[model samples]
Structures are given as structure tokens and as C-alpha cells.
Target: MGIRDFADYLGISDRAISNWEAGGESYRPRAASQSVLDTGLARAPDEARARFADALGVSGPGPSAAAEMSVDSHKFLPVFIGSDRAHRLRTQMTGETPPDWLESCSAIVAHPHAPTCTLHVFACGVVVFHILQPRKPASLTELAVWRYRSYASDLPWARAKIHDLLGEHHPHGPNPEYVLSLYWLTAGPWIGSQYDTAMRLLSTPSVLVDRSAPGGPVPLDGAVEESLLATGFDHPDIVSFGVRGVSTGYAGWSGVSYAALSQERSLTVEELVSCELIVQALWCYTHHIQQRIEEGSDPSTPDRYGWRFLRAANSRLTTARAQETAQHCLMREAIMRTSGLAERLRAAQEALRESMG
Candidate 1:
């Protein structure tokens, strides 16, 4: 088929089809578009299919379009943990009896900075943790550390903040019931907030003082080197060190990955601890806001209404302080969502005020 005919057949823009035909190193069909292309090839005449497949450099319709096109799924295998193992770990970390519903839960660890690290605790006690990464894959140990830290340290602060803001007898410390309830309500936005925080930190400019380079500290974008400086991160064995914007091959997600020259050193414990605190704080604040929305007591409030089902599963309390907390949460979310440089700066200023007060 001609480009226009193929575009029409695939129900996509002709430009996209043209990009596909041009066979550039970066162009690839979208996942949905790829599926359509595969289906069209499957139904095409054998000769036509062979021509199209040859143009795209694929064996046939059976293989992934990513192979023919310069597409990447950014997919990774999940580290599965049975409910019993998760519960035992939780108990060991927090010294609390895990909720009965934890028996069917599984944890997935992906890229630490990716917003995909989120927990979903079902009413029946089944929890699924989706861990995503921006560039490299995360190990099971890294995932476990994040989980343990969230439960042991982050959860208590979240609970206390909620109780203090709402002026309720909410459970204190890392009680599994309260923790799970809170996660169920706030995990989505909280996870996003954590990712935003990491990105913000990564975006900061910094100098990498490579010992091998006698020329003094070299300047680089902090975002690329932030992952390298992270604890337990193994430096990629490649020798290349430069920045290039690469397509993640996934729609709506694209960024630059830094190729850093490997050094024989790692981030200090204090530096790692500081970075972890920033991440933990973002999650805590978001959780606080989610809790306030739940405790707003007015079903008409949009945030509260949206989370009604989750609220129903947990205790409800309301107060003037809780409303104020909701306002702060809204402000934080707004700051995270801001786009323009000036707008973001203003949002950050306002966030400072919110945090101080």
C-alpha cells in the first residue's frame, strides 16, 4: 500500500506512516498503531506483507514491532514476593502484627525515580506494588529497602501528621492497619509526588569530581548523575559519558539519560540519607493531604468524593485543621503540576510558606 493508503488503513496520521517508511533510527509506531500495523500485515497478500516487513526490517508480524522500528518497551521483570514473605518482613521491620489481608500481596520493584512505584491495597488485603524505572532496572533488594523504609519510617510520620491535623485518635506508629488504609487512599498521587521530587533533585546542576581526571571537578547535569550517586546503584560498564535525549519508546514519557564515566567511588552515607529524606518527605506530605481530603467530611468536596470508596473503608474525622491540611495538599499538588518556569518558581515560593507554617 502507498503511504496514504497505509495510514488510512491503520487509522493514523499520514505523517506517522511516512515516519515509519522513512526508516529513521528514532521513528517507531505507537503501541496501538503498531498493533494495527501488525494486524494489517497479517491480512495482507504474501508479497505485499514481505515488502512491508522488509521495509520495516522485521521478520514478520509475529515479532515485536520494536524490533523492526527503533522502539523500546522499557519493560522489566517483576520481583514477586508472596504475602507470607512480605508480612514477615513487615513484622520484622515495624514490630507490628501485619493485617490478615496481606497474605495475597506481591511487590514489584522497578526504577526508583519512576512514578510507577505505587501500592494498591485491596479491601480483601491483597496488595500489588508496581515499581517503575526511568532508565535502568532496580533489584529486589532495592525494592525491599524502599518498602521497609516507607513502612518503618515514613508511615509513622504520615500517621502522626494525619492525627495531629485532624485532631483525632488515629493510631500512632507503623500500625499495619492504619498504614495500609493510608496507602490505599494516597498511593497514586503520593507516588507521583515522590517521582517529582526525585526529578527536581536530579535536575539540579552539580559537579562530579572524578579522581582520575586531574583537571578538577567536571560539570554535568545533575539529573543524569543522580542515579549514579544513588546508593546501591551499579555504574553501567560502558565508557561513554555524554547526554542525549532518547525516546523511551513509550508514549508520553521521554527524557535524557546520562552516560557517565564510571568512577571507583560511591555516594557517602550522609548524601544517600539526605536524598532518601527528600523522597520520604514528598510521600509524607502527599499522604497528609490525601488523609485531609478523606477527613473533610463533606461528600460534595471533589477530592473527598473521588476517594469516597477508600474513605468508607477507613475511619473518618473532620476539623478546621483538617481543612487547612487539605488546602496545603492542594497547593503542593499544584506546585508539582506547574509547567512554566515563572509559575514553578512561584509555586515553590508558596510551598516554602506552606511548609514553614
Candidate 2:
């Protein structure tokens, strides 16, 4: 921040700031001013804190080491394309070789909304669209405001892309329940353990920031960050999928994942996205049946997605496979419990049984 901006932020004079700068270690502000400075440090965006730490010769995870050297936003929209469509697209689109452990491959696709978007096709019936938007946020607060404002329109844009992709490629495939979102944060100004607070707020944006303000939501500045720091933040629906320090994130019913560092992330992005795809597709499928029960009609789907299909999905999702990590298992279970996927599946199963009887 510039000198004047810093002064205005602290509710003080620019000249006083100049004197403090000139005085260096010799001049210390009075008690009230010291309190204000402390709040400024606490409430300032992750970037400002990073620079402050850098100036003080304290080193940590600053965004300077990143390839971009600036903050960027990653948005993912995943849908189910099933095995057959995934195969067809694999042949149609030229893609880089997949990692031996991964059954997924991605390719750049023409998108009307975002030029830098790519389509990731997973062997297990899921496809995700990844969009990258470059931005220079002055503070985490500024970024928070932008996220709340832009998300209103982003869902529709993704839905349009999915509609087009399916219309042209997989007409008979099951429709996506919703264009659910998952966010990844890369190269932010936040340093040290501050990334923890940043990730919590990012994962559940509505907790600290009031997004319901009349003239659109505005950041409460230090009040926002300070409150979270003091009381902590948690929501039953939001699941923390990654570890705390090396890399961090949470996946929730509201959104899939929000993380600070892209490197050595605790949970693979593929697992989180695939988990969401299965959960939401099942959620949508069961909802269709539940609605039919509500309307006094017997519900039915193509034999492929019938009761047996749900039974296999339940076992596949609930059972532990040979090589699954505990973290991956925990994340999948948390998503199922929080989203009520298991409950929905049982309810749908019962309804189907009664109709068949």
C-alpha cells in the first residue's frame, strides 16, 4: 500500500506515517496508535502481511517464489460424462499422456466465456472444466468481495458451456445436477500461518464477510478478519480435506475445495472433484425419484441408472479400496455425510422397492 492509503486505512495522517518511517526503530507510536497498527497488521490482506514479514526479515510461504509471482483464481465445473462419452472424447481431442496412476487426461477446449479453460475427462464418468483468471487483489478482503459478486454469474456461464458440450457430444448422457464450484488459490500475499485463516474464510466465504448487504457486500476490514481469528470458524457442511501447514483446503456442500498452495497439496484435486461428481449426480438422481414420490407417481430411470446402479455406487463409494489414502477416504465420507448422499440413496432405494412391489 502507498503511504496515503496506509494512513487512510489506519485513520491517521500521512505526515505521521512519514515521521514513523523516518524514525525507524527510534520512534514508537503511543498506546492507541500502537493498537491501531496491530489491527492493521491483523486485518490487512494476506499480501500486505507477506510484504511486512519480508521487510522484517521473517521468511515464510510468500507468493514471490511462485511462477506467476501474483495471485490467480482457479474455478472448476465438473459433470458426469459416463465411460462411453469419455472414451469418444479421448479419441476426438488430442491430449497429453495421462499419469500412470491417474485415469484422467485433460485437453484445452474452445470456450466462449473463458479462453483459458480446459476439459478434464476422467475414466470413471466425470468431466471437469477448469478456468483460470489472472487478478491482482490488493487484499484478501478485496478478493473476498470480488468472489461474492462474480459468483452470481459464473454458475450460469459454466452451465451454458456444459449444455453446449453435451448437446454436441453426449446427448443421451445423464444431465449434471448443477454446475457445482470448486476453487483453488495460487500465489497469494498471505504468509506463514495466516494462510490458515485465509483458507477458512475462502472455503466458507459467508462466515466472516456478510454477503447480504444492500449495496452489494463490502468488507468490514479488520473487523472481519479479527473476529475469525479470535473465535475461529467452522460449519458442519464444510469439510477440511487437506493438512494444516504444508498445504490446506476444505470441501463442502456449498463448494468442493478451496486451497492456498498448488504445490504438494494434501488431497489430489482429482479425488475431490470426482467425489463431488458422484455425490451430486446421485443427489440429482435421487431427487428426481423423491419428487415423483411427492407427486404420487412411481419413479423410474433407464436400466443403467436403476436400483442396482445405485447399489453398486453405494458399495464403491462406501467401501475402502486397496490403495486409498486415509485422507481421501475421510474426504469422501465427509462429503457423503455432509451432503446427505447416503441418506438420499437409501430413501430412493426404499421408494424404488415399494414401486416394484
All candidates: TM-score: 0.22, 0.60
lDDT of 2 by residue, 1-357 (tens): 799998999889999899888988978876556656654654566676557656655445532434332445556665655566667667666674546322557788765555577777665455666766666666556666776666656655656665676565444444444444565565655555555566666666665456778887777766767667555666767766553322455666665444533243246556666676556656655776787899999976556556777777777778866566545666777677667888888888778777887
Q: What RMSD does each model have against the real structure?
A: 21.9, 15.7
Sequence-dependent TM-score of model 2: 0.60
lDDT of each residue in 246-334, candidate 1, tens digit only: 00000011111111111111112222222222222223323433444467532122232123322322221111223222222222222
Return the top candidate by lDDT: 2
Q: What TM-score, to 2 decimals, does candidate 1 have?
A: 0.22
Local distance difference test values of all predictions, in order: 0.30, 0.63
lDDT of 2 at 176: 42
lDDT of 2: 0.63
